[model samples]
Target chain A: MISTFIRHELKAFWRSKNTGKSIAVRIVMIFLILYLFGCILLAGIGMDKILEIAFPNDDLVKSFCGIVLIYFLFDLFMRLQLQELPTLRVQPYLHLPIKRNTLVGYLAITAVFSMFNLWPFLLFLPFIFKIIAPDSGIIVALAFVVAIIGISVFNNYLALYLKRKSNLNGWIFLITAAVLILIVIADFWWHFYSLHNISYAFFGRLLTMPILAIIPALLGIVMYYFNFLYLKQNLYLETLTARKVKIYKSNTDIPFLSRFGTIGDLAANEIKLVFRNKRSRSSLIIGLFFMFYGLIFYTNKSLGQGWYLFAGMYMTGAFVVNYGQFMFGWQASHFDGILVSKINFSDFVKAKYLLFTTVSAISFVLTIPYVYFGWHVLLVHFVMCVWNIGVTTTIVLFFANRNFKRIDLSKSGTMNWEGVGASQLLLTLPLILTPYIIYTPFAVFKHPDIGLALLAVTGFIAILTRNYWIKQLEADYYSKRYRIAEGFRNK
Target chain B: MIEIKNLKKIYGNVTVVDIPHLSIAKGESVGLVGNNGAGKTTLFRMILDLILPESGEITSNGEIVAGHEHWKAYTASYLDEGFLIEYLTPEEYLYFIGGLHQQSRAQVDETLTALGDFFNGEILNRGKYIRDLSKGNQCKVGVASCLLQNPQLLMLDEPFANIDPSTQFRLKNMLKDANKSKGVTTIVSSHDLNHITDVCDRILLMEKGVIIKDIATSSSTLSELEDYFGVGQTVGATPVVKIDEEENH
Candidate 1:
């Protein structure tokens, strides 16, 4: 029965509707996976040398053991962002005559085949075989390898369980991310404790007392059994899936927006859309994370200060770029209704412009504390704000029409590459390059102030011609409305 | 109120919708009965100006519908789930549609109060988005949205398919009352001949992208449509042979 279940999974991968149609995308993904595998292999082979460079005085094996817990902690964090649960694969088998245990066991075991489970072996196995085995007995070496695998499995299942719980209740995800952030802050900024010594003390014993490896193995088994029971009980179709959100009552009225009449109504709808969907809402949350990104660059002050422009642009315009790039797609679920509704196309486009301008302005106000770095940083940010509102916003909205991939609103955005398309990947070129084109000439002449002036001037032009750009975009959209509608309908 | 002249929409070589010429009167309740893929939806899409036709035009009230905004003022259509926003609550969606038709929120609330029985208390203020609602409840929302707009021309596709039996009866009576009082020209396509026959005054039976039977509904319209549909075959329903049997009647 397990074999049949695995076979069904294999067939599902091969016959997925989206694959085999985009050969170029398939080739690109394969190369990306291969590149990741190559990096892991090189890291595995060079582990001892890396340890020697980082900690020259300590024993290589000791240093490695010291970092095992740290490695597992980082692994859990990465898995939280990258891993996906194959929870729905069991839906097809639920009605069959097979025992429920068989299906649950199949999902738990098959989940271990993830690249997260394998990348560690490619990273640490070489050091274990070369350094640990020759010095200690082979049994001790085997115990070390067993301990590493055990911890990897434990992290894998634990992350999956937390993520599963988070899917059921969104607050769980927020709380888990908050706790992880707090831990990092406490350990790094407070310097009140050291995770390094704690890990060394725990794993350092496994080398001398091979029997101590049983602890990690026991942890792995406990986590696996916990996941098994959870999956067994919740494998029912309705339970594994998310239901309607009924937790908090939110006001449906936006008094300020309602005053704008139809465009205001559309903007209010767009706001509700961003807050309601898992994928789009995650983008909103992630955009907030970038508001703090300037600290990484502003404090350094050594990267030639050109980076401040890029960072400032991102800090103020990330949401505009991220959300506006998928502008029409956010409404792809109901493009048919929009096409037939009484609302004018230009009014819809005007609503989008208003949304982008409003978000960019709000993000700028929220980042005012960044001016403490230098008034220069604030000046660059102000210019970029105008540029984003005037130029980048239009560029992303134009690309939105070319994107045909319909995003399923219920699915989370992290590691789920559902709505990504070639248009989005290509959109960044104009956004990044145009400002440089306007900026580089004056900077070459030792008067970089001239470059900022030119960019601002061009942005001023764009801002002044907002109505014209909107009309042009509206005309372009009118020509392709049917095709866009068809693309969305097929999905 | 609606006219389709020399309309032709072909998918590759297959003629999906090929109506030579047809006109629906201003107050006519027309039922479009056909097998699956017999161009019922394709025709409705053209009438709504959602899809472009290849060789002809659809004019809503003498104005060419394609690329025109004037027709939408009085035309409200709910062809499928595609017509719904799906992310808003039922009340929110109704107000949005009402806003499009320039109806005040208070007026919309009054209209929704009238539809409270048809909604069956599962839609409005249910704290669920339309996408999360059950198929039956979603249908109630979609149909109720059409009624709230006070549109002169309203279109609904398969209004009886997913609705509960009790709601279906309520819907039939509501549609009948709305048409009788407002004289709204409605275009509805349905597979259930009984419900549509009870509601629509004129029935157009299409087969292989052609209107094979156009008859005013009477006592025997359901039996005639059933004979055309045959038993146990919905998609493969062939109505060409029923023309001769109909002529004999």
Candidate 2:
């Protein structure tokens, strides 16, 4: 049964419409995984030497034991973000002769085959052989290895359970994140208790008495059973279909936008599109998170002024670059209606301009607190804001005309390459490099202020000549609209 | 109000729409009937300027449709689910479309109240996005939005394919009333011979990418189309092609 399921999965992957693109992504991912595992293996082999150097006065084995729990804690955090639940088309098999328990058991077992489960062995196995075997004897070392495997399994099922619960009620996700943050703060900032000492107390006993290792193994069994029960209870088609009929509240109208007329209406709809869909909502969240980007460079006093410009540009314009690159593709689902409706193409272009400027302006205002780093930081962000509105908006929309792939808005954005095309990849070049090209010569000659002035002037001039750019965009859109519509139709 | 001149759209080697000249007059209720792959959709797309033709032009009210924004002021179309903004609720979608035509919210609500029976109580105030609605209900939303536009030119492709029987009757009446009362030029394509014969004053039969027959609707129109399609015939009976010759003569 498992072999048949694996064969079907392989066929689905190979037969998918985006097989060529997925194959390329897979090759890149494989190289990345190998590189990460290679680093972990080297770290494992040299663990004793590193421990001795870092903790010169403390016992090496005790320090290593203290780090084990910390490693797993970090492992659990990473797993929560990266792990995917194992899904099978069990509907077809539910009415067949196969037992429901067998399907649930299959899902639970396959869920264990993830990179999170493999990283522990790569990072801990060599340490176990070199340090623990001769000192604690082979049997004790084996028990320690069993404990590591047990804890890894426990973490796997626990993360999957929490993720499933969160899917049913979203507050579970927020509460889990809050609890994790509180744990970090209580241990590190409040000094309420010490996790390192607690970790040593648990793992150090395994080194002396091998029987204590059974505790983690037992915990692993309990989590596995919990997941199995959860799956069996919620396996019915009724539960699956019933969860999708969520009661949606109508979006309230923004009275302020009514003053702008049709352009305002279009922009208001775009805002709802961003908030209502999973992929677009995540994109907006990521843009908001990038407001902290200046913290990395602005804190470093050694960097040149040009580096500040780069960070400031990114901080204020992240949403413009992130969301604007897929401008027309976001509307691919209704592009036909847009083409034939009572809307002028120029008004459509104006609405996009309106959305970009509004978002960029809000991003700039949020970065005003960065002036505490230096007044220069705020000045640079202001210039970048103008550049984003006038220059980057045009570049992004220009590249948008070439992107025809339709985005499925229902899917999450993390690691999703659904609407991505070569145009999206190429768009990043001019966006990042164009400012540097204009700013480099002045910085090299020690006249950095002149470069900033020149950039602001260029942006100002573009703003003044906005009508010309709008006409150019309208023409470009008309020429490529047919091809874009055709591509969208194919999907 | 729509004119096509030598309009041809080719997909690789096959020409999908190759009409030399086809014109729709004001207030004309036209029915387009054809089998699968008969270029009915491609022709509609060309007329709406969604698909650029290989070697010709389409015009609305004597202005070229390509690169012109004025035509959109009077044209409204619903070809498929692609025409719907699926994330919006039915009421929200209707209001959005109505807003484009400068219709007030009260006006839109009044129109919805009138369309309540056509919607069959499944659409408005349902607290469901259009994407979550069933196919038949989604079609009702699409058709209702087109009506809200109050467009001088309205086009719909296969609107009856996914609708219920009673709703189909209501839609036929709506199209007829739009043509007679408001002078709205409607182009509807359907596979149902009975519905097309009842709703349309003129019917155009398409084959491959060409119009094989064009006739005024009469008592014999439905049977003539049925004969060409070989409906109610015994197994292995070929569709009659002589109707094309007769129509040409």
Indicate which candidate wins on lDDT.
2
Each model's iRMS? 1.7, 1.4
The 10 consecutive residues of candidate 1 chain A with the worst lDDT sum are A242-251
Pairs that collide, model 1 = none
Candidate with top DockQ is: 2
Give, for candidate 1 chain B, the lowest lDDT window spanning 10 residues: B234-243
Clashes of each: 0, 0
> CAPRI band of model 1?
medium
Docking class of 2: medium
Candidate 1 at residue A325, lDDT?
A: 73
RMSD of 1: 5.3
- Give lDDT tens digits, candidate 1, residues A176-221: 8888877767777997677777788877877789998888899999
What lDDT does each candidate get? Answer: 0.84, 0.85
Instruction: Tell me the tens digit of each residue's lDDT in model 2 across A376-400.
Output: 8899999999998889998998898
